[model samples]
Target: MNLDSIKQSLSLWPTELWLLFITLLGLVLASFINVVIYRLPLILRREWGETNLPEISLSWPSSHCPKCKTPLSWRHNLPLVSWLIQQGCCVKCKQKISLQYPLVELAGGSLALLIAWRFGANLSSLVYLGFALSLLALAVIDAQTQLLPDKITLPLVWAGLTWHWVFSSSQMFDQAFLGALLGYLSLWSLFWVFKLLTGREGMGYGDFKLLAAIGAWLGAPALVPVVMLASISGLLVALVLKLNAKWQGQALPFGPHLVIGCLVLLIGGQELAGWLGLGAWLEITSWAF
Candidate 1:
């Protein structure tokens, strides 16, 4: 019942049992992520239509099989397990389902377990878990659709702020707030400058907000480096896709890079700063050179 008792029980549990639990939890979260990924766009469209724009809904009525009108049963909805058991086909219509569903669930579970192993049972652990799950959802959604829905991004911003206030110290809070402001303003400035210079949009407003959320979680000092790291990673991904002869205008999601950067930060931000000479060494090098 108590925290200590729970912790003790967890420690006493076999590694396999712990892993199974984490995997099940991850699968459940991923199942909900399917809904979020599917519905966020529609919700946004509806909101846009309500504001007087004519955008059609993504899905009307309820979630019925596209091939058959029969509703899915609880037994058919068991995340990756159900899909695996059913051979990735609908039971009613026997239509093949995309592997993305199970893959997302597996990725979510694996990432959750990894974060738990890294951070343990502290508040930081919970934050890391939430961060990983959100990133998993964001990455899948962004890859499937070029859009990064505000339904996720805005809540991520609030979650970061909430975590800082509730779990971190005043110093951490200060860093997070400053990070959010600088992160948002920095991109906004770049967008204006790039547009003015080239008559083109370099990035989206959603990216700015997402980075702000990262800032709130990581800190102000991390903003520029994270942006730089993400840019480089994004370029590499773009290059690979383009080399394979993908369209020039194909949208590349910036969310994954941010997620990767934050994960790096979570795992070893201080060490990375030292290696990159972003701290005392950088100042010394600048002065000497």
Candidate 2:
């Protein structure tokens, strides 16, 4: 069918149907993202070390129970349902499975449904959904390993700039470019300054690139809110950890907080800014520019 005909047919469907479709799509993608979260770091490490570690790619080495090494059949691979069916245990070995799988899938599905509802069934929704999934994957990976591979972050930066340049009407190319520049520079400057003052590193270069990618997508106006929100979230988490005696001297990953910040900004940035009284400051700054 022609594109117009397809659009017309889609328009006829109920909103719930579209939401369900996107949620299902998100669940499937989240399963794949699970593979990525587990494998990408290993792949990067192997590549860096120039070692042969059985050549594991995302597609290679079919999904299996890590404890049992048994390849999963279709029945066992269903996103959130299969885990519930088996009661969160490997069917073969009866070993308990990590809850991460179901949680990630649920998060992915919810985010997809939210995007579908917010942006409708449009290219913009699809693109932002992809961006949100990437951020989710990055956050989880960083939380576990304290690493954000360039494989993901670098492409995200390029994709953000390309999306804004080609598809964005609200943000100009110059704004996107400046956003990226400032996002990276702002973090980079802070990194060095903090290191100089405290003789310890506060954050990593990956964070700078991640923010740059965010800036490219949301433009320069988003940088302040994103950073502020991330900082506040991080501080709260840190305080909780400290109070609970779980705080370690080891570095905590900041990517997850930043990802949360990006999502907040993307979903309701203007409303949030207005509520916080930053809207006036933003307007005054724009006037100065």
User: Candidates' lDDT values, in order?
Assistant: 0.71, 0.86
Off by over 4 Å in 2: 1-13, 50-54, 282-289
TM per prediction? 0.81, 0.92
- Give me candidate 2's TM-score against the actual structure: 0.92
Task: Judge candidate 1 at residue 85 and give its lDDT.
Answer: 93
Steric clash count of candidate 2: 0
Clash-forming residue pairs, model 1: none
Please report the candidate that would top lDDT against the real structure.
2
Writing each residue's lDDT as its tens digit, candidate 1 over 1-289 gives: 9766765766775666665666677778877777667666667766766555433344444454546756777788887889989998888889988777788788777777776666554445556677777877776676766667777777887888787887678777787888788888988899899999999887788778888888877778777667767877888888788778657766677777877776666655566756765767434422110
